[model samples]
Target: MSHRSFRALGVALVVWSAAFTTEQACAETPIEQARHVFETRKYTVVTVQLVIKRQYSFGGRGSQEREEKQEASGTVIDPSGLTVMSLTDVDPTLMYAKLAKTQGMSDYKMESNVTSVTILCDDGSEVEAQVLLRDPDLDLAFIRPSKKPVQPFEHVDLTDAAHPQMLDELLFVNRLGKVARRTYSATLDRVEGIVTKPRTLYIPGQQNQESNAVLGSPAFTLDGRFVGIAAVRADLTESTSLDKGLLAVVMPAEHIAEVAAQVPPLESEGATDGGSS
Candidate 1:
């Protein structure tokens, strides 16, 4: 081979290497930015423990009652330990009723009552909390410590939120279940679409088990701006098909903040029952 030909080949290889490096860096930029938000705000994600007593009745068939303890992910929305989570997770009777109707089981009836509530902190401590508000329309529940924490808690500032366009990527942070040691985890999802009529809702792209995100996971933009929280929107219209009836959406943070603003003071804890429909 001629020396001139060898030199030309070497230059081509170097150019290709530089181009590949630049492409790789650009791909990593979003992930690195998202990592900052995850590490800084992971503590805001916590576990909520609930003991619920449920009653089930099959018309003229029989009735059953059971008490079960469950754990769900919750996001701290205020420094005072005010947290928010999916109301459906705490009480799934509504969802069950919808499913039953869809399956042509009109005789199915179910009711539930939250017997106890506790917030599990990252430091292995537990705080007794009570449901301050429940919004079934939006699938949101606000809870606060029975007694204010001695020190301020790390929380997400919902007021400072970002509005993402369709096809934009989002970062979601959540806490794993007991089997996974309740560790904090993160996942990425894209804004699949936006529903503006009736009410504005952001549709997230398809999620799989590997994402490890749950109902209460908080979502953010790639640049570390708060986006919203994951929730389910159930359409109860009889004409609506089951598949299209229930939708998973990212409820805007501003909407959540509006509801959080209505949370009653701790003194009036039992004014609104969380389990009531």
Candidate 2:
């Protein structure tokens, strides 16, 4: 009888331990759960598009300005349509010129780089978007979809991606925006090299204007937490044009506290796009 009683107690204790663990897991905070998801499923990450209309000298400079539309990509940083983009996508001078005209506040040229405005979702959807804030010196921008758009996307938080260590498996989502075909699942070969340039920027097609910039897409660690914001893919050696075919650039968020503090916590906007090439 004593032996049987001890056996029953041991079984009961095992069951109780398992039950307690499950309860703790189920009671995890949303932030904690989000972080877990980010770490495990970063591949389904999403990006957005910028629909910018600008006028520039075209056709061997007939000395005439022609209007043209250009697109760029962005990473959905939140669920309410807030996103991160490459400030290099917008010419600070042009954004300022456009801003001046829109605000009717003053006529300023090159004063505001043209945040030449437009937006697209990596799931092949297009939404008009506007620049909310910019750090031209750092080549970073925050954007919001216009007309309160709804789209599917996934958001990632920026963590310590720049930490020196082994280069981990990562992914990129590229959106072409009617100019070219969409390409997904471009892997980040490494994260070990450090860039010393102060003003790194991307010009989607300058090196090959036909290339794409899934502008605001997030560069995530294998765990899916946002490690950086996708910027232009440019060669450190050339610095004059983009090399989208062989390279990609990013805005490390760990170093953006100064810029982020200048802006408000943006409204939320995003959805999941977790899949692979």
Candidate 3:
């Protein structure tokens, strides 16, 4: 072979090698960084359980009474054990429907018949909590311990909110249901777009792994900065029924921090009017 042809081949091989190394480095950095973040923040997430009684009607038989339990995920926001969860978990519309049926009333309205609520910690301990308030505008619910904790609980600082650009990679963790031992699984997702009309954020890439059970899970940037909370944007059971299918949205951290800051002062001043036991 000619010396000129040999030199050209050598240049091509070096370029190819450089490209492969760059691709590998780019791929590994984000995932490893995300795993680190998940390990540090996983405990801040908790399980929420609600117990209530509802009435269900049969075709021929009359309505029968039964007790039902619901479960969801929440994020701890403070040392006092203040946590935030998805409003849909205890949505007034659905709760009122159950209540109306139990009362044998025909009108449909919003009401609460929750008999009890409990928070499951990472170490497997449980704490009873009170529902402070549910903001339908934000579609979030705030809850706190009914009694003081023996030790300060682990929480995420919303002040460290992360802002990522479109198509940027991010990290989130989901807890398996009791049937799956309630273990944590880390997922790598991306920001697909942003909505301005409703002041919303969209994550269309993580749809398949999300479920109603994982609502309110905390999301973080690739570097492990807390970004926001994940919520189901459409009907869980009827995803296809919606024109856009099921969308999982992450409420921005700045908005959540602004809302969460209001709760502590209210509790300190002995304001209990907004709470539900």
Candidate 4:
């Protein structure tokens, strides 16, 4: 073969090899990893609705009534439709604080009227859910759907997930806002560090604009193991000045399972009475 032809063939081979490697890397990306995990566990993540009522008196006037609706993400844990969501969803103190300041009300009080707690299913159907327990320490709440579906719902076994180490790559699943068709987003982040004071935690590297949306969303390892759920920690120790930001942390699966096991069982049938080890 001519020298020119030999050089061209070698270049073509190199290009092919590079292209193949790039494709492989893309397939294993954190987004892809998150998608794979979600596809299998889609039914576990659900939408929750909370009905709130507010009572306030202005300028020595009698108490008046105000109504509000709030929504949040929850994770189903059992066939009986046990689920967990953020405590702030049902009890929003910060939201009320802002409202009080804005309206200039002397006495502002808000409580969950909770006329109904509806659970949005994976198949786009809705069902009634009931609040069973609230753990203030963890800032987590447990709930159960009132009626059982014909087919058993899927759930994430928190104990099954592997414990993550520092700097490990992980993926989390979060649903878009109401304007968005409730589609889930797969987020990739590195474990920036850990804090051992309150509990063993997995902290994300940097804060992003979408960080608030991912709160209460479940995080997973690349191989599809549940690491924990995304939580926020506010550090005001150093900052007496004014600016306050939230740091994302992973509430480890083991800890979640331990707390979940103690939650009371539903009144319905076919529920697991055994503790989650």
| CA shift of 193, model 1, Å | 0.5
Q: What is the lDDT of residue 115 in candidate 1?
A: 74
| Model 4 vs. true fold: TM | 0.74
Better of 2 and 4 by lDDT: 4
151-216 per-residue lDDT for model 4 (tens digits): 777778865886778888877777666788888766778888877876888887675324567767
Stretches of candidate 2 off by over 4 Å are: 1-63, 92-118, 122-126, 147-153, 159-166, 176-183, 196-216, 232-248, 256-258, 264-277
Per-candidate TM-scores read 0.85, 0.52, 0.73, 0.74
Error of 4 at 92 (Å): 1.5
After superposing candidate 4 on the true structure, give the runs of residues whose Cα lies further than 4 Å from its correct spot. 1-31, 56-64, 94-109, 208-210, 234-245, 268-277
Best by TM-score: 1
lDDT of 2 at 261: 53
Better of 2 and 3 by TM-score: 3
Question: How well is each residue in 52-89 modelled by candidate 2, as lDDT tens digits?
Answer: 33343323443333344455556665555666666655
Clashing pairs in 4: none
How much is 253 displaced in model 4, in angstroms? Answer: 1.7
Writing each residue's lDDT as its tens digit, candidate 3 over 1-277 gives 9999999999999999999999986778666878778899898888888876555554445666667788888888888888888776755455344345554554433334567778888789999887777776676888888888898888888878878889988777767779877788777778887766667565636453355545788888877788888865543232233335446688777777778777754246443424432
Segments in model 1 whose C-alpha atoms lie over 4 Å from true places: 1-28, 208-213, 236-240, 267-275
Better of 1 and 3 by TM-score: 1
